[model samples]
Target chain A: MLEKNKLYTIWVYLQAEPLFWLTLTIGAFLVGDYLYKKSKLNPLVNPVAISILLVASILIATGISYERYFNGAKFIHFMLGPATVALAIPIYKQIHLIKKETTSIFISLIAGSLFAIFSTYFFAKLMKLDIEIIYSMMPRSVTAPIAMGISELIGGVPSLTAIITILTGIVGASFGTFALDILRVKDMTARGFAFGLASHGIGTARAMSRNETAGIFAALALGLSGVATSIIIPLLFKLINF
Target chain B: MLKSIFIIFLFQLIGESIQKYFELTIPGPVIGLILLLISLILTKSTKNIFITKTKEEITTTSNFIIGYLSLLFVPIGVGVVMHLSYLENNYIEVLGVIFFSTVLTIGFTALLMEIINNQFKKHARKK
Candidate 1:
């Protein structure tokens, strides 16, 4: 009986330790990665998506607040900055292709950025959602940090914006390839750009898994679209006074 | 691997400095990306010392980083739990807008890019 009590006390202490959630995150990703690999790289088996579902479920079941989980998980989040900077290497490698299509890339960036923002706004408005919801939805297609930044600047809820951005990523990462195929957008560069523009980092990851050229274009589009949207969304919002 | 990581973080730091100095709306890492690209281009053109080896190291290191890029986002994705009630209350609009707008954005962006790309190719051939 004493041993059982000691064990339980240790368990409770461990649960509150940041090391615990950190280990859980890495372990969950390992499992998710294993399943993803076993499934032959199916988009449906996306490791991030699976890991999120697993982590969220565990948090809910254990009654641990999301903040507690993030205490450890934030370490992983910090890596995103470096990872994003690393993307420049891939883009640099594909500079020739990007140079060749600079004009088209610019055009696509503008069109895609505006279309994503407006379509999100229009849809939210049509649904009669609140103005704040529309504002948060406006930056859904950009990466989370930029999206959240833009959402906050535009008077929206950053957490909600982050969630919406994740959902956009899941949707784009899952359905993007199929949609591109149906539309006969067979050029890998175009397909990758579309995916990244609509889904950001997650979509870029999906594209990176497929081909190097696709990954480069996806990164280019992802980086540029974020920059473009950050500048454009704020200006447009201020102009419209929304 | 360590060298590559140092280079990446250095660029990120530089980028953060520039972003803060300029008060730009874009993230620091993105600005770092641009700076890194420009430096890479300069290195390639100027025949700088150790350029080949540096490029090779960066390429190999970045490849590994990019391979598991999606995994880094898992933490943020899990942030969904922080806003469960908001999502639940607005589930209909949330899911519907995400589904419709994401699909529309993807389809529209791809179609437009294809059109523009074809036009560029045709114009380049003429030129």
Candidate 2:
């Protein structure tokens, strides 16, 4: 029975190894992405959220602590910084489109960013969420990395902000089109800017898939709105003493 | 691909340095983003190695990174489990707030943008 014992030993070793969790992280992402594709890229089947559930459930099932999981998963997390830096390329490419509608694009961007912040704040307040939860929720309208960063600065749990941000993205991507249609917004640019500003990357992805002009404007606003929110939310919090 | 990765990471490092040096509140990656955007704008004419990357090279690398951007967030997103205690009692309200705010934000932004664009068009016609 040495062979059986060897298998058990290997399993035990795998559990302790950081690479196991890393592999799980990538594998889970693949599975999630596959399902997202199968769903025809349904916004509800968000790859990131699915991957998160897959990993979190596995972690809980295995009784492995988050710290241990993070020990392995941090490699993927580390890529976030560089990926964020890479947003400049898309933003740069979209700059040409912005030149024609500069006034309209800039105005909607500021208005949307402000609405994202204040609406979240007042709604969370109305819902009686904790101050910390409110803080984490403030940047939910922006991309995940910057949202997490903003959450950290505001003394909120960055991790929670990540989840909240993902949830917000799914919500935006899923309902955004329907909402825009209801508003009778025919302009692709407006529709795109709305998705990018309110929904962040997920909405931008949806916008891109649906229409080219919408996609371009969506991407442009995705970067601009993130920059806008990152600068505004923290200072706004201090002024509101929140 | 390796070169692309290097350029992206290099910009990120430069971004971090500038943020740290200036004691900037903005994240370094973001600063890196702005700097890279500026660099791309200025270096439309590339001549040498350090700044030699053509737009195609930088765009290829950045696009590669952006392609897998969502995957990078998976690790941190899963950390939401630790906050399970907070949600145990009030998940509905929290989710309600999130959904409502998101819907409101999207609705208002789209509506406002449509109105503003119409106004701009009207002003242009007047001109």
Candidate 3:
């Protein structure tokens, strides 16, 4: 009984330890990465998904509130801002390859960004989904960080925005090439741009695996469309008053 | 690497300040991105040795940060999973909407892009 009591004390101490939760977050990712490799790098076996599940399960089992867990994990979350700003470096590197097509590229991407926003908006409304869900679905065509920000501003549930954004990435990555093939759009650059603009990082990953040109264009679209969507959605919201 | 990171943070700070004052709807980091891009462009041909060293550091540090980006989202990803029940009723609708819109957006962008590029090339030839 004395040994059991000592063990409980250690567990309680660890629960509140910021380093413990931080280590657990990283440790969960390591385990998730191992499983991802074991699964042959399958898309559905997403490391982020697996790690989120692992930590969420542990949190639930331990009955720890998310606020406490986040207290420890906030260090990791805080990097997102610096990392997002760092995005400009890569986009700058790719500037020369895209210099000639800059005009066309920018126009196509803006069209795609607006299309992504409004198409989801109208479809969700047509289905009679809740307005919050509609707003959530609207910004999901971008990456999670940007999408969640838009979700917050436009009255969407940020959590739902994150989940649905991942769904869009998975869907676009899985079927993006097939859909493009069907559309007779054989230009790899265009296809890559479509993948990034519509699906965000996951589709960008898929495009990267295909070839170099496709990968570059995919990356270009990912950052530019994110920036464009950020400006466009709010402006549109102000205009539409919804 | 540390200096590169500080530079990134510096731009983010500038961005946050400007965004707050202007009441911009854009994310501060995104605004920082534009500022960084413009700065990189402005310094593209500079002869300053210090600027040269900083540029290389920025590249490697930013790439390192980007490589582990998915790891950083783990917390929010976990938060979203907890709230899955809130979206449970609209799963089909959400999935359906995502599929069609993604497919449509891809097709529209690809087709229109090709057409615009071809037209641009022909116009250049005519000129």
Runs with alpha carbons beyond 4 Å of true place in candidate 1: B46-51, B123-127
TM-score of each: 0.94, 0.86, 0.84
Model 2: per-residue lDDT, tens digit, A106-190?
8888988998888888988998988888888889998887898888988998877887887787778777777777788898888
For model 2, give the RMSD to the true fold: 3.0
- What overall lDDT goes with each candidate model? 0.87, 0.81, 0.83
lDDT of 2 by residue, B1-127 (tens): 6777887899899989997898765678878888888988887667766665456777887777677767886777677655566565668877898888888888898888889889988998999
Model 1 error, position B5 (Å) = 1.6
Worst window of 10 by summed lDDT in candidate 1 chain B: B79-88
- CAPRI verdict (incorrect, acceptable, medium, high) for model 3: medium
Q: Measured against the native two-chain assembly using Cα atoms, what DockQ does each of the candidate structures obtain, in the order listed? A: 0.79, 0.64, 0.60
Ranking by lDDT: 1, 3, 2
Interface RMSD, candidates in the order listed? 1.2, 2.4, 2.7
> For model 3, how does the per-residue alpha-carbon lDDT over B21-112 read when each residue is reduced to its tens digit?
99765668878988999999999999999999999999999878776766777776677666667787787888899989998988898888
Q: Would you give me the overall lDDT of model 2?
A: 0.81
* lDDT by residue for model 1 (B5-118), tens: 889899999999999998877899999989999988888765556767777888898888788798888887887755668765788888899988888888888888888888
Give the better candidate number (2 or 3) by TM-score: 2
Looking at model 3, residue A178 earns an lDDT score of 70
List, residue by residue over A40-150, the lDDT tens digit for candidate 1: 878778888889999999988888888888987888888889889989888887888998888889988999999999888888989999888888889999998899999
Report the Cα lDDT for residue B50, model 3: 100
